[model samples]
Target: MAISKKISVLLNLADLLAKNKPEILRKNELDMNSFADMDESMKDRLKVDENKVDGMIRSLREVAEQDDPEGKILYDFTREDGLHIVNRTVPFGTILIIYESRPDVTIEAAATAFKAGNRILLKGGKESFNTNTYLTELWQRALSENGFDTHFVEYLNLSRDETQKLIKENTHNVDIIIPRGGDNLINFVTENSSVPVIVSGRGNNFMYVDDDCDTEMAIRLILNGKKRISVCNALDKVLINKNLPELKEKVSDFVSELHSKGIDVWGDKKAASIYSEIKETNDKMVLFEEFMAPKIYFSLVENMNDAIEMINRYSGGHSAVIVTNDAEKADTFMQKVDCAAVYHNASTRFTDGGQFGVGGEIAISTQKLHFRGPLGAQELVTNKWFVYGKGHVRE
Candidate 1:
């Protein structure tokens, strides 16, 4: 399909969603009511309301406004034998995105893949079947109205066994698969998929407080990172330098702030000695845990090197932050830490596609391959090499 037609369809779909807000919300309500056994975190991700609808509309508009990602020449050259060669971006043919709750993906992922000229097949969890079905219907209507094929975007409501069979069998000739959810889902897709898979949506992020850090600013950063616990980029572990001046007082104030916010804090012996209320645990496994709730794990580090080592060893390679006034130390941390997004004296909460000014995202990729960090529309495409030759044969 033409890029203009694609953009028009997206804009029209945004308008349709905005106009049919009530109907959409009613369908979402039915889904929400039916899933009474879900945990609070899952519900938070599953529920769809006016604000989320607004976000979906905004994402569609932004994606439509961006330039077409396909057919852009990345490299052009000629050989001595008069053969022309060029490398340009192209769609992946078909992309399969398997995700759990978070109906927003139904719009963002589909819009991104479609705008890039790829067929998208969304396999969402059962908890969001109603909402996803309704959204897919709207997409079909938009495509048909714009004189485009409805096959551009499709939704698959499959059970666990069916999903596994689809992945293992590759019945649809999927070019790539993106799995966005907890570790279990990610592992299942990674182990079972016959196609190339992009691993995303796992966040065991960390933050370190340096010896010369601004204690007050550190507190603010910590609070911001913990504000939303259901997201992948939320902070899970914190490492504090034990040699900092007034360490006990700072730990006490930090603990108090976390407690006031009803966050459960677990600390090492050094931090536990300062804050008696903090539950003490010496388990190293906590360092690798991704707490998608109001919980945090704390430990004391000897110095900058120790902090960096710990962060690199335990982080999910999603995001890591270092709060320090020393520019040299911050630079070192930002460079040495192996993660998709690294921050210096800033909150890890800014690790988002929209926040990074890339429109919306399909997922926050944690693996290093074609792309890492947020998978924006532009990142959804791969390149193809084109060669032109007339009567030229290999010698």
Candidate 2:
């Protein structure tokens, strides 16, 4: 099919989604009870149709217009033989994404794969089967309408066992497999799959508010990061300096104030002094991390060195926030923190696809290679060199 026709089909899918997003959100909200039974294994919900699928296509189309991320020559140099050598961008052939209960994955993955000019196959979580099915159907329809093989962007329809088969036995067909979800889900895919896997590192995200931080700003950021605390990027641990005279009082007041509003808070010895209900434990829950919803824990530090030490001890390199007016402190934390996404004063929630302005993204990759932070359009692509040289033969 012509590139223009393919582009048209994608654009139409976007328009349909923009017009119908309100309805989709409304429908999901109205049926919230049915969608609320949470499972870590689930990829995303299954309720997508033409309208839902369209939005994803639109975001990809928007990013594609920016510039061809691939195909641009990165370097050119002369060899000892006076021959020209060049390096450029190219696709990674076919990419495979294995994930759970987030319908947004469908659009983000599809759009990005399309933009990169690489074929893709999605193995969605079983929980979101119905939703992903419809979403895939719309994509197939779009492809058929544009006279292209839907296989270029296929959605696999196999069980967990079948998914395993594809990951292991079908390694020849799939170039790379990306597993997105929680720790266990990602772990399972990484361990069992024979194909090369890019570990989308487990989220042990953190938020730290130094003694120099603005109290009002600190409270707002904490609330935003921890309120819906079940998310991957939600603030899991909060660290505060013990040197400030009002350190205990200030943090306690802010934490208690939120606890009064149906938020659950658990804190360490220093944090417990402020809020009585905060859970106190000997072993750092930070070590064997639990992704709890509506829970906030605290750790007290003696100084900057202490704070940095604790941050290093617990942080799994997912996300961290430093709430301080001190430029040096923020800079130090940014340099030391091992996480994929590091924050200065903003909430950990800002570690999202939409906020990062990549149109949209899949999971924020905790891994370093292939992807890190938000997995958007560029993450979905791999580059190869395109050389145009005259009489470039070896001696």
Candidate 3:
């Protein structure tokens, strides 16, 4: 299909989705009801309400309005030898995205890929089967109505064994595989898939509070980061400067705010001394853990160097925040921290595609290869080289 036609189809799909909100909600409820044994965080990701439906519609429209990613000339030049060369963006041909829960990904991810002129294959978890199936039907309908092949967007509802077979055999010629889920799923796809994989969705994000930081603002940022425990960008660990004036008061205030929000605080020995209610944790492995619950790990750091080292060692390279008033220290932290998104005095919760103004994302890639942070429509395309040369013989 032509690029403009694809955008028109997406716009139509967005309107169709908005008008059929009741049907989508009904299908979502079936998926929600079937996952009774799932954890609260996973369940939160699975649920799709009116707000989520609206978000999906908005994302489709936003992506449709954006410039087409494919065939955009990135670089054009003529060599000294009179050879003209041009580099342009192109689709990856076939993209397979395997994710768990989050029904909105069905719309956003597919829209991004289709808008970029790529065929998308969605493999959603069984828990969201009903919703994913319904959404895929809508996509097919949109394509059919727009005089496009329904195969442009395909949904795979395969069992565990079947998934393994597909990944191992590469029967569909998937050019790239993106896994948007926890570590287990990402690791499974990376290890089993024959295609190139992009790992995403793990976020053991950390926040460091420097001695010169605004304590009140730090508390607010922490609260914001912890407000949504189900999201990957939610804060998981905190490191506070031990030399901060009134360190005890700061810790007390932070712990109190978290307590008010019904979140559990786990702290190291130094932090535990300030807040008696804080549970003590001695295991070093917990630092590497991504807590997708209302639980955060706290510790004490001597200085900025210590905080940077700790984050680089333990963070999932997702997002990190440093709450400091000193520009030099904040700049140093931002430069040294090995994360996809680094923040100074801001909440890590802003690490989202919509927040970044990319409509929506297929995933927040933790890997540093093809792309990092939000994988938006513009980031979905690969580059191609077009060279022009006359028939000339080389010496």
Candidate 4:
């Protein structure tokens, strides 16, 4: 913690990072193109392409250079006995972040930790080892340049066995563990890790087309929501009103187009004639839940009440969008949907850090405790009370 030790650490990390920059950039360049061309499975595992990764680092640098998330005074109160209570924000100190194939997550999580004054141990998806290593090196370089402890951003370059060992053995040193991946991966980390967890749950976002929705705008919004279906915020479900004007003509045409583009469609018997492209099975429930990204389901509902019930039954508690020109209708749907974020007149895909005007987000938090939506550095800090009082004897 000494000034000299800090300087030494920063300098050494800077030198190591400087030595590795060119090689890292070269590797990233190759990854950029190859990753962009990869199929849905490979792309989903990586999450983002290289150009986006570069943009992410830039965004982090800008975010870090801004005012700190900590150092803010939240509240102050005084008592009649000359006692004062002041609430101030502070960092969690040490955090462990476990995530799947989104390589950019390593840098983003590290930046949030750095801004909050916490040390981070990152365990990224093995599928993106090469990408993770270089990104971690980039973040270390940034930390060194800022004269912060480079070791504050650590990584465990190990397989499943070693990862489980660290989680089991170093629980005491870790103040919190954040899991940022699929349901199974997150469940595994949360169930097994001895440290407290900030779980970022998986998203199966929904999009509802209300009777008041503009048909042209609805098509555009739905396409935008599902264009990048691999993302956590991508629209996974589409709900259409059973009795919209030209309901069959407008929605049916749009749904058919989606099917042509490889999206699957499922729905009630009323919608069955429109979505024949979706391969159905004898088991209705099985077909309804089984979504492959281009696939969407349409169900005819009598009113907003039915739509609300359907959403509650199917939503994965991440993001939901309601397309309605009517203000009251939008409000009703938003109120009924249970998720981290709800949208009106916009694509569910807009549920993102940058979209919300934050420079970047650690991840979309589905948990209610520390954070609930797109999380920036401000979401990374906890609060403490500072009390002051004059001597007063008890009666």
The C-alpha RMSD of each candidate to the native structure, in angstroms, is: 1.2, 3.6, 1.3, 4.2
Q: How many steric overlaps does candidate 1 have?
A: 0
Mark the 10 consecutive residues where model 2 has the least summed lDDT. Answer: 39-48
Tens digit per residue, CA lDDT, model 2, 323-370: 899999899988888778878889888887767877666557777886
TM-score of 4: 0.85
Per-candidate local distance difference test: 0.90, 0.69, 0.91, 0.70
Off by over 4 Å in 3: 79-82, 390-393
Error of 3 at 312 (Å): 0.4
Residue pairs of candidate 4 with colliding backbone atoms: 263-294, 264-294, 264-295, 264-296
Q: Across residues 335-380, which tens digit of lDDT does each residue of candidate 1 receive? A: 9999999999889999988889888888899989989999888998
TM-score of model number 1: 0.97
